[model samples]
Target: MDDIFHFDTLLAGPPDQLLKAQEQERQRIAADLHDALGPLLTLIRLELGRASELVREDDLSDLAVVIGRAHGHVAQAFDELRRTVVNLRPAMLDDLGILPTLGWLVREFERCGSGLRIRTDFAVTEQAVPSHLKITIFRICQEALNNIVRHAQASHAALSLTLTDESLCLAIDDDGCGMPDNSHRGRGPAGGTSSIPQRATSSGGRCDITSGPGLGTRIHVCWPLAGIRP
Candidate 1:
């Protein structure tokens, strides 16, 4: 058994290899954004500025429509860029910790077309979690809330966080259509079961999804508190 374990270790290499690969991919994406998309956005901004100036000078009626369309396109491009950056890694989670960031997210979602009511309950204080753990919890909450908004058709949702002596728990619940199969676990279009679980595991946590035909879905996650840095 010892020899087999050693062989398996040799074949699998170190756990850090996966972390390194994820970091490398992150670096590659950052480089592409800076080198290619960044310059293209700058060029587009410059052209738009020049076109605005021309529209002002020409005073053509159709020029107003064209400039309006250009402005809308530019705004949309900026929104997409912002969304991409957030999805890559939420800056607010790193800067403000989980609670405040979650507050902001919930407020934003409430403002959207979905008339969902969100209730936030925090059993832990603001300083309860370390920075890394806070980020992890925040990301999980973001993912869960996003799923709710996209698929729930739910009228009400709740987000709750609790901390005990040994562990931290985060949960998001929605009163929308539940999962088709309570026993089966898989991913969905937005992010199937596999992806969400993988993310939670990567953050040293575990996630479980519970739902039924008429019963809404709830995502529950928990992580240990020992040695977690604030």
Candidate 2:
């Protein structure tokens, strides 16, 4: 009960503590994999290689082939684990900061070959964003883009992050076939879209979703600058 942040009431604790916990946990899990599973997987691959070599020297071609295949599978697993760790918590977010991380995220989606085009306009620089808000902004952008790519049939989308003297704002718009005003409005069957607003609220931000049957979708989220300080 002392963990101020609880989900039962749509974030009732301190302004953004729950999100901080979630992020810290992701970093922890990623580090654990890097420190533990990584070396174990490497050792497993080396052992399989040694077995393959021993079978080959014994003139047991079939056994050698089996051991070689096992080694290949182990190698593939090792690679996949590395990818999983990266997805858990991208290192660029910590090393290069949020701007580069956002750029990398956009580039990755573009490479997905979804035939969707996305444009970004950032009115604020890396230094302008509060440290506590960067990851929240990045995650909101990630979820919004995911929704556009998955549900919006239109090919063009735009993202903008800007800050005024008093508030910070993020907006995403798409040219796709928009949702009906009567629909769930980000609370529909799409869990991805639904989580966008939740994430904003968890960080003490307000989220707005606007769309009509054929008018496309627009998501706007904002926070008062004073409340977002770490």
Which candidate achieves the best TM-score against the true structure? 2
TM-score of 2: 0.71
Candidate 1 all-Cα RMSD? 8.4
Screening candidate 2 with a backbone cut-off below 3 angstroms (N, C-alpha, C), the clashing residue pairs are none
lDDT score at residue 91, model 1, on the 0-100 scale: 88
Candidate 1, residue 124: how far the Cα is off, in Å: 1.1
lDDT of 1 by residue, 25-89 (tens): 58867875676557657766766776777776986656666566667667766776787687667
List candidate 1 stretches off by more than 4 Å. 1-80, 182-184, 188-194, 227-230
**Cα deviation of 71, candidate 1, in Å:** 8.7
After superposition, which runs of candidate 2 have C-alpha atoms over 4 Å from their true positions?
A: 1-68, 186-193
Tell how far residue 190 is off in model 2, in angstroms: 7.9
